[model samples]
Target: MPMTVRSNCTGTLPSVIAGSAYTCSRCAEPHDGPPLGYGTPAPAYWNVEAADQPGSVLGEEQCVIAGSYFFVRARLVIPISDLDAEFDWGVWVSVSEASFERMSALWDKPERVEEPTYFGWLSTALPLYEPTTLNLKTKLHTQPIGDRPLVELEPTDHPLAVEQRTGITSARVQWIAEQILHTNPPMG
Candidate 1:
Protein backbone atom coordinates (compact mmCIF):
# COMPACT_ATOMS: atom_id res chain seq x y z
CA MET A 1 0.00 0.00 0.00
CA PRO A 2 1.17 3.50 -0.79
CA MET A 3 2.29 5.42 2.31
CA THR A 4 -0.38 8.04 2.81
CA VAL A 5 0.61 10.58 5.42
CA ARG A 6 -2.51 11.04 7.46
CA SER A 7 -3.01 14.74 7.97
CA ASN A 8 -6.00 13.39 9.83
CA CYS A 9 -7.03 10.39 11.91
CA THR A 10 -10.26 9.06 13.32
CA GLY A 11 -10.64 10.09 16.98
CA THR A 12 -6.90 10.59 17.26
CA LEU A 13 -5.37 13.10 19.68
CA PRO A 14 -2.24 15.08 18.84
CA SER A 15 -0.73 15.38 22.28
CA VAL A 16 -1.52 14.63 25.91
CA ILE A 17 -2.29 17.44 28.32
CA ALA A 18 -1.33 17.20 31.98
CA GLY A 19 -4.00 19.48 33.44
CA SER A 20 -6.77 20.82 31.25
CA ALA A 21 -10.27 19.95 30.21
CA TYR A 22 -10.68 19.39 26.48
CA THR A 23 -14.01 19.26 24.68
CA CYS A 24 -13.97 17.58 21.29
CA SER A 25 -16.54 16.30 18.85
CA ARG A 26 -16.27 15.11 15.24
CA CYS A 27 -18.71 17.89 14.41
CA ALA A 28 -16.38 20.72 15.46
CA GLU A 29 -13.57 22.26 13.40
CA PRO A 30 -10.96 22.45 16.17
CA HIS A 31 -12.20 18.96 17.06
CA ASP A 32 -9.95 19.05 20.09
CA GLY A 33 -10.55 22.12 22.26
CA PRO A 34 -8.17 24.05 24.51
CA PRO A 35 -6.99 23.05 27.95
CA LEU A 36 -9.55 24.12 30.56
CA GLY A 37 -7.12 23.78 33.46
CA TYR A 38 -7.99 21.74 36.53
CA GLY A 39 -11.51 21.89 38.07
CA THR A 40 -13.22 23.08 34.96
CA PRO A 41 -16.05 21.38 33.07
CA ALA A 42 -15.30 17.70 32.88
CA PRO A 43 -14.56 16.06 29.54
CA ALA A 44 -17.33 14.29 27.62
CA TYR A 45 -16.00 10.77 27.35
CA TRP A 46 -16.55 8.51 30.31
CA ASN A 47 -13.44 6.49 29.51
CA VAL A 48 -11.45 9.61 28.70
CA GLU A 49 -10.23 12.70 30.49
CA ALA A 50 -9.41 16.13 29.07
CA ALA A 51 -6.18 16.47 27.13
CA ASP A 52 -3.89 18.73 29.17
CA GLN A 53 -1.55 21.24 27.62
CA PRO A 54 0.63 23.18 30.00
CA GLY A 55 0.21 26.97 29.79
CA SER A 56 3.91 27.47 29.29
CA VAL A 57 5.17 27.16 25.75
CA LEU A 58 8.10 25.35 27.26
CA GLY A 59 7.85 21.60 26.88
CA GLU A 60 9.09 21.41 30.44
CA GLU A 61 10.30 24.54 32.34
CA GLN A 62 12.49 26.53 29.97
CA CYS A 63 10.98 28.98 27.50
CA VAL A 64 9.07 27.35 24.66
CA ILE A 65 11.37 26.48 21.81
CA ALA A 66 9.63 26.31 18.47
CA GLY A 67 9.90 24.31 15.24
CA SER A 68 10.71 20.62 14.56
CA TYR A 69 8.95 17.79 16.40
CA PHE A 70 8.99 16.03 19.73
CA PHE A 71 7.22 13.01 21.20
CA VAL A 72 4.15 13.58 23.38
CA ARG A 73 6.35 12.22 26.14
CA ALA A 74 4.69 9.37 28.04
CA ARG A 75 5.78 6.74 30.54
CA LEU A 76 3.18 3.99 30.24
CA VAL A 77 -0.16 2.91 28.80
CA ILE A 78 -2.57 1.97 31.57
CA PRO A 79 -5.55 -0.10 30.51
CA ILE A 80 -8.74 1.29 31.95
CA SER A 81 -12.48 1.38 31.50
CA ASP A 82 -12.93 4.40 33.75
CA LEU A 83 -10.59 7.41 33.59
CA ASP A 84 -9.54 7.75 37.23
CA ALA A 85 -7.30 4.72 37.61
CA GLU A 86 -4.99 4.95 34.62
CA PHE A 87 -1.29 5.58 35.29
CA ASP A 88 1.83 6.46 33.31
CA TRP A 89 4.84 4.36 34.37
CA GLY A 90 7.81 4.51 32.03
CA VAL A 91 10.38 6.75 30.36
CA TRP A 92 9.55 9.93 28.51
CA VAL A 93 11.35 10.04 25.18
CA SER A 94 11.36 12.84 22.63
CA VAL A 95 13.16 13.05 19.32
CA SER A 96 13.48 15.54 16.50
CA GLU A 97 11.46 14.95 13.35
CA ALA A 98 14.65 14.23 11.48
CA SER A 99 15.76 11.54 13.90
CA PHE A 100 12.22 10.26 14.20
CA GLU A 101 12.03 10.07 10.43
CA ARG A 102 15.25 8.13 10.38
CA MET A 103 13.98 5.70 12.99
CA SER A 104 10.78 5.30 11.02
CA ALA A 105 12.78 4.44 7.95
CA LEU A 106 14.64 1.81 9.94
CA TRP A 107 11.50 0.24 11.37
CA ASP A 108 9.05 0.48 8.45
CA LYS A 109 9.75 -2.94 7.08
CA PRO A 110 6.65 -5.13 6.65
CA GLU A 111 7.83 -7.54 9.32
CA ARG A 112 8.15 -4.90 12.03
CA VAL A 113 5.19 -2.75 10.95
CA GLU A 114 2.58 -4.96 12.62
CA GLU A 115 3.93 -4.59 16.16
CA PRO A 116 4.50 -0.79 16.42
CA THR A 117 4.33 2.72 15.10
CA TYR A 118 6.35 3.82 12.12
CA PHE A 119 7.12 7.15 10.49
CA GLY A 120 3.55 7.29 9.28
CA TRP A 121 2.26 7.51 12.82
CA LEU A 122 5.06 9.68 14.19
CA SER A 123 3.56 12.98 13.01
CA THR A 124 0.41 12.52 15.06
CA ALA A 125 2.12 10.76 17.93
CA LEU A 126 4.81 13.38 18.64
CA PRO A 127 3.16 16.50 17.24
CA LEU A 128 5.42 19.52 17.86
CA TYR A 129 9.04 18.79 17.06
CA GLU A 130 11.64 20.75 19.03
CA PRO A 131 14.60 22.67 17.59
CA THR A 132 17.22 22.32 20.29
CA THR A 133 18.64 19.76 22.72
CA LEU A 134 19.80 22.05 25.56
CA ASN A 135 16.41 21.90 27.25
CA LEU A 136 15.92 18.33 26.16
CA LYS A 137 18.77 17.11 28.32
CA THR A 138 17.66 19.45 31.07
CA LYS A 139 14.21 17.87 31.03
CA LEU A 140 15.80 14.45 31.30
CA HIS A 141 18.22 15.51 34.04
CA THR A 142 15.51 16.85 36.31
CA GLN A 143 13.33 13.75 35.82
CA PRO A 144 13.67 11.08 38.54
CA ILE A 145 15.63 7.94 37.79
CA GLY A 146 14.75 4.27 38.53
CA ASP A 147 11.17 4.21 37.21
CA ARG A 148 12.63 7.12 35.28
CA PRO A 149 12.93 6.34 31.58
CA LEU A 150 12.76 2.61 31.35
CA VAL A 151 12.44 3.23 27.62
CA GLU A 152 11.95 6.14 25.25
CA LEU A 153 9.62 5.26 22.43
CA GLU A 154 7.41 6.85 19.83
CA PRO A 155 3.73 5.94 20.08
CA THR A 156 3.16 3.15 17.61
CA ASP A 157 0.68 0.65 18.90
CA HIS A 158 -2.59 1.98 20.21
CA PRO A 159 -2.98 0.96 23.88
CA LEU A 160 -6.71 0.79 23.28
CA ALA A 161 -6.23 -1.95 20.74
CA VAL A 162 -4.16 -3.97 23.19
CA GLU A 163 -6.72 -3.46 25.92
CA GLN A 164 -9.47 -4.75 23.67
CA ARG A 165 -7.55 -7.86 22.83
CA THR A 166 -6.38 -8.95 26.30
CA GLY A 167 -9.84 -8.92 27.93
CA ILE A 168 -7.86 -6.92 30.47
CA THR A 169 -9.76 -3.78 29.55
CA SER A 170 -9.95 -2.26 32.98
CA ALA A 171 -8.09 0.36 35.05
CA ARG A 172 -5.78 -2.20 36.62
CA VAL A 173 -2.79 -2.43 34.31
CA GLN A 174 -0.96 -3.94 37.28
CA TRP A 175 -3.24 -6.90 36.82
CA ILE A 176 -2.16 -7.17 33.22
CA ALA A 177 1.43 -6.88 34.39
CA GLU A 178 0.80 -9.60 36.92
CA GLN A 179 -0.75 -11.81 34.26
CA ILE A 180 2.31 -11.28 32.12
CA LEU A 181 4.58 -12.08 35.06
CA HIS A 182 2.61 -15.15 36.06
CA THR A 183 2.67 -16.53 32.53
CA ASN A 184 6.45 -16.09 32.36
CA PRO A 185 7.34 -16.50 36.03
CA PRO A 186 10.75 -15.51 37.46
CA MET A 187 13.55 -17.71 36.17
CA GLY A 188 14.85 -18.60 39.60
Candidate 2:
Protein backbone atom coordinates (compact mmCIF):
# COMPACT_ATOMS: atom_id res chain seq x y z
CA MET A 1 0.00 0.00 0.00
CA PRO A 2 1.11 3.55 -0.68
CA MET A 3 1.99 5.70 2.29
CA THR A 4 -0.13 8.82 2.58
CA VAL A 5 1.92 12.03 2.57
CA ARG A 6 0.17 14.04 5.26
CA SER A 7 0.46 17.80 5.60
CA ASN A 8 2.76 18.79 8.45
CA CYS A 9 2.07 22.47 8.08
CA THR A 10 -0.46 24.19 10.33
CA GLY A 11 -3.55 26.20 9.44
CA THR A 12 -5.36 26.40 6.12
CA LEU A 13 -4.43 28.21 2.98
CA PRO A 14 -6.28 29.46 -0.04
CA SER A 15 -6.00 27.13 -3.06
CA VAL A 16 -4.91 30.16 -5.08
CA ILE A 17 -1.58 30.35 -3.27
CA ALA A 18 0.98 29.48 -5.92
CA GLY A 19 2.86 26.23 -5.34
CA SER A 20 0.68 25.69 -2.24
CA ALA A 21 -0.79 22.52 -3.74
CA TYR A 22 1.00 19.71 -5.58
CA THR A 23 -0.86 17.50 -8.05
CA CYS A 24 0.59 14.01 -8.12
CA SER A 25 1.69 13.24 -11.67
CA ARG A 26 0.77 9.59 -11.26
CA CYS A 27 -2.34 9.58 -9.05
CA ALA A 28 -3.69 12.98 -10.05
CA GLU A 29 -4.42 13.76 -6.40
CA PRO A 30 -3.52 17.26 -5.28
CA HIS A 31 -1.42 17.21 -2.12
CA ASP A 32 -2.22 20.34 -0.14
CA GLY A 33 1.16 20.78 1.49
CA PRO A 34 4.74 19.62 1.11
CA PRO A 35 5.52 16.33 2.75
CA LEU A 36 8.10 16.47 5.51
CA GLY A 37 8.97 12.77 5.42
CA TYR A 38 8.23 9.20 4.31
CA GLY A 39 8.97 5.85 5.94
CA THR A 40 9.11 2.13 5.21
CA PRO A 41 7.08 -0.28 7.30
CA ALA A 42 9.81 -2.90 7.31
CA PRO A 43 13.25 -3.64 5.95
CA ALA A 44 13.58 -4.85 2.39
CA TYR A 45 14.96 -8.18 3.60
CA TRP A 46 11.74 -8.91 5.45
CA ASN A 47 9.96 -10.44 2.49
CA VAL A 48 6.83 -12.59 2.44
CA GLU A 49 8.78 -15.81 2.96
CA ALA A 50 10.63 -14.32 5.89
CA ALA A 51 7.46 -13.06 7.52
CA ASP A 52 6.68 -16.31 9.36
CA GLN A 53 10.18 -17.67 9.62
CA PRO A 54 11.26 -18.86 13.01
CA GLY A 55 13.99 -17.07 14.95
CA SER A 56 12.98 -13.89 13.17
CA VAL A 57 11.72 -10.79 14.90
CA LEU A 58 10.41 -7.59 13.42
CA GLY A 59 9.59 -4.64 15.63
CA GLU A 60 8.83 -1.00 15.20
CA GLU A 61 12.42 0.05 15.80
CA GLN A 62 14.47 -3.09 15.36
CA CYS A 63 14.51 -6.31 13.37
CA VAL A 64 16.29 -9.65 13.36
CA ILE A 65 16.12 -12.15 10.56
CA ALA A 66 17.18 -15.76 11.03
CA GLY A 67 18.99 -14.67 14.19
CA SER A 68 21.78 -13.50 11.90
CA TYR A 69 20.58 -10.37 10.09
CA PHE A 70 20.13 -7.30 12.27
CA PHE A 71 18.45 -4.08 11.30
CA VAL A 72 17.36 -0.80 12.86
CA ARG A 73 14.99 1.86 11.69
CA ALA A 74 16.52 5.30 11.28
CA ARG A 75 15.90 8.74 9.88
CA LEU A 76 17.89 10.04 6.89
CA VAL A 77 17.30 13.78 6.99
CA ILE A 78 17.89 16.12 4.05
CA PRO A 79 17.83 19.85 4.48
CA ILE A 80 15.48 21.80 2.23
CA SER A 81 17.17 25.00 1.05
CA ASP A 82 13.97 27.05 1.02
CA LEU A 83 12.18 25.67 4.08
CA ASP A 84 12.86 25.69 7.78
CA ALA A 85 11.67 22.08 8.01
CA GLU A 86 13.64 19.13 6.67
CA PHE A 87 12.80 16.24 4.38
CA ASP A 88 13.28 12.89 6.05
CA TRP A 89 13.39 9.31 4.88
CA GLY A 90 12.50 6.82 7.59
CA VAL A 91 14.81 4.04 6.44
CA TRP A 92 16.38 0.90 7.85
CA VAL A 93 20.04 0.04 8.15
CA SER A 94 21.73 -3.32 8.62
CA VAL A 95 23.98 -3.41 11.67
CA SER A 96 26.33 -5.95 13.09
CA GLU A 97 25.05 -8.27 15.81
CA ALA A 98 27.22 -6.55 18.39
CA SER A 99 25.95 -3.12 17.43
CA PHE A 100 22.38 -4.40 17.37
CA GLU A 101 22.72 -5.86 20.83
CA ARG A 102 24.15 -2.65 22.19
CA MET A 103 21.34 -0.63 20.63
CA SER A 104 18.71 -3.02 21.93
CA ALA A 105 20.15 -2.94 25.42
CA LEU A 106 19.97 0.86 25.40
CA TRP A 107 16.74 1.15 23.47
CA ASP A 108 14.71 2.40 26.40
CA LYS A 109 17.43 4.37 28.09
CA PRO A 110 17.87 8.10 27.60
CA GLU A 111 21.61 7.69 28.10
CA ARG A 112 21.73 5.80 24.81
CA VAL A 113 22.13 9.16 23.17
CA GLU A 114 25.67 9.22 24.52
CA GLU A 115 26.63 6.03 22.75
CA PRO A 116 28.91 6.15 19.75
CA THR A 117 27.51 5.91 16.25
CA TYR A 118 27.17 2.39 14.84
CA PHE A 119 28.33 1.36 11.40
CA GLY A 120 25.57 0.06 9.16
CA TRP A 121 24.59 -0.67 5.58
CA LEU A 122 21.58 0.90 4.00
CA SER A 123 18.88 -1.77 3.82
CA THR A 124 16.17 0.22 2.11
CA ALA A 125 16.25 1.28 -1.53
CA LEU A 126 15.02 4.78 -2.17
CA PRO A 127 13.24 5.83 -5.37
CA LEU A 128 14.28 8.40 -8.01
CA TYR A 129 18.00 7.86 -7.59
CA GLU A 130 20.07 6.52 -10.49
CA PRO A 131 22.24 4.17 -8.50
CA THR A 132 20.39 1.83 -6.15
CA THR A 133 20.28 3.08 -2.54
CA LEU A 134 20.73 -0.37 -1.04
CA ASN A 135 24.06 -1.32 0.52
CA LEU A 136 25.23 2.27 0.93
CA LYS A 137 27.57 2.80 3.85
CA THR A 138 26.09 4.69 6.81
CA LYS A 139 26.70 5.69 10.40
CA LEU A 140 23.74 5.35 12.72
CA HIS A 141 23.71 7.99 15.43
CA THR A 142 21.53 7.16 18.38
CA GLN A 143 19.10 9.79 19.55
CA PRO A 144 16.99 10.27 22.69
CA ILE A 145 14.77 7.50 24.04
CA GLY A 146 11.80 8.36 21.82
CA ASP A 147 13.67 9.42 18.71
CA ARG A 148 14.81 7.19 15.90
CA PRO A 149 18.50 6.87 15.14
CA LEU A 150 19.92 9.20 12.47
CA VAL A 151 21.52 7.53 9.43
CA GLU A 152 24.36 9.59 8.03
CA LEU A 153 25.70 8.50 4.68
CA GLU A 154 29.44 8.28 4.28
CA PRO A 155 30.89 11.29 2.46
CA THR A 156 30.84 10.16 -1.15
CA ASP A 157 29.80 11.14 -4.65
CA HIS A 158 26.39 9.45 -4.54
CA PRO A 159 23.54 11.80 -5.36
CA LEU A 160 21.81 11.04 -2.06
CA ALA A 161 24.99 11.81 -0.20
CA VAL A 162 25.43 15.05 -2.10
CA GLU A 163 21.86 16.03 -1.35
CA GLN A 164 22.39 15.36 2.32
CA ARG A 165 25.59 17.35 2.38
CA THR A 166 24.61 20.32 0.17
CA GLY A 167 20.82 20.30 0.66
CA ILE A 168 18.08 20.20 -1.99
CA THR A 169 15.81 22.87 -3.38
CA SER A 170 12.03 23.00 -2.83
CA ALA A 171 11.52 22.14 -6.49
CA ARG A 172 13.61 19.02 -6.01
CA VAL A 173 11.51 18.08 -3.04
CA GLN A 174 8.36 18.44 -5.15
CA TRP A 175 9.87 16.31 -7.87
CA ILE A 176 10.75 13.66 -5.32
CA ALA A 177 7.21 13.61 -3.99
CA GLU A 178 5.83 13.16 -7.46
CA GLN A 179 8.15 10.31 -8.32
CA ILE A 180 7.63 8.47 -5.06
CA LEU A 181 3.88 8.95 -5.17
CA HIS A 182 3.71 7.29 -8.57
CA THR A 183 6.20 4.55 -7.91
CA ASN A 184 4.80 1.04 -8.10
CA PRO A 185 4.60 -0.75 -4.73
CA PRO A 186 5.16 2.76 -3.34
CA MET A 187 8.22 4.10 -1.57
CA GLY A 188 8.61 4.79 2.11
Candidate closest to the true structure, highest TM-score: 2
Cα lDDT of model 2 by residue, 3-77, tens digit: 434322222322122356877666788885456666777788898777678889889888899888999988898
Q: Which stretches of candidate 2 lie over 4 Å from their true place?
A: 1-19, 24-29, 184-188
Model 2, 106: alpha-carbon shift in Å? 0.7
TM-score: model 1 vs. ground truth: 0.22
Off by over 4 Å in 1: 1-73, 77-79, 97-168, 171-174, 183-188
For candidate 1, which ten residues in a row score worst on lDDT? Answer: 37-46
The local distance difference test score of each candidate is: 0.27, 0.78
Task: Return the number of clashes found in candidate 1.
Answer: 12
